[model samples]
Target: MSRLTITLDDQLHRALKETAARQRRSIGSIIEESLRLRGIRTYDSAMEIVSKARAAAGLEPDEALELAVREVRQLRREKKT
Candidate 1:
């Protein structure tokens, strides 16, 4: 495995140390897990992106479902032509 040398702010560094201690894991393992999770950004999948968009539009669960169903039905109608 490759070694990484990075710096962290005082608060973030202290939090990392505390988390490692609480979890009974090494700092390296804590950092690896944090990096892995950080790399998985918002909207990693198509459905996630769609969910985010729906939230931004202030659509409730039922409204969002209706919108999706309508779009699917429209697509099917177009496909039948």
Candidate 2:
């Protein structure tokens, strides 16, 4: 595990703490989940996901890459809306 030091506004800090307490989860976990939900993945993790999707769909490498790119772009657009 790695340690991180982040500066948050007083209100946001309080809210995060409260939410963590309510959910019975550590604040770090909540923050990690938020980051993952927002598509902020490490390179290895992203590759793992792509590999799994390709295997499941029986796609060729290039075809899988193209499909993954298109789906990611569509997801980003949907998130923006």
Candidate 3:
């Protein structure tokens, strides 16, 4: 396990504390989880999730991420429409 030193402003600090309390986790744990989720924003990192979700679903590379993104939008659209 690794740790990072970070400075947060008033609102952000309170938000993190609230998130940690709501999730029944420590502040450091919440930060690590948030970082893990955002790690997929990069191509290389997202590609790993694409590969995993693809192989597990037996989908082609081109189809996997596109399918997930499509389904996400479809669900949101369904909620509105």
The Cα local distance difference test for each model comes to 0.71, 0.87, 0.75
Cα deviation of 28, candidate 2, in Å: 0.4
> Please, what are the lDDT tens digits per residue for candidate 1 over residues 1-81?
888888999999999889889999999997777555444333445356457658977898777767755765676566556
How well is each residue in 1-81 modelled by candidate 2, as lDDT tens digits? 999999999999999999999999999999998887677778887688679879999999888878877877788777777
Q: TM-scores for all candidates?
A: 0.43, 0.69, 0.45
RMSD in order of candidates: 14.7, 2.7, 5.5
Q: Write the per-residue lDDT of candidate 3 for residues 1-81, one digit (tens) a residue.
A: 766888889999999889889989999877766655443256776577688789899998778989767765675566555
In candidate 2, the residue pairs with backbone N, CA or C atoms under 3 Å apart (3 or more residues apart, or in different chains) clash, namely none
Q: By TM-score, how accurate is candidate 2?
A: 0.69
Superposed model 2: Cα runs more than 4 Å off: 49-66, 79-81
Which candidate number has the best lDDT? Answer: 2
Better of 1 and 2 by lDDT: 2
* TM accuracy, model 1: 0.43
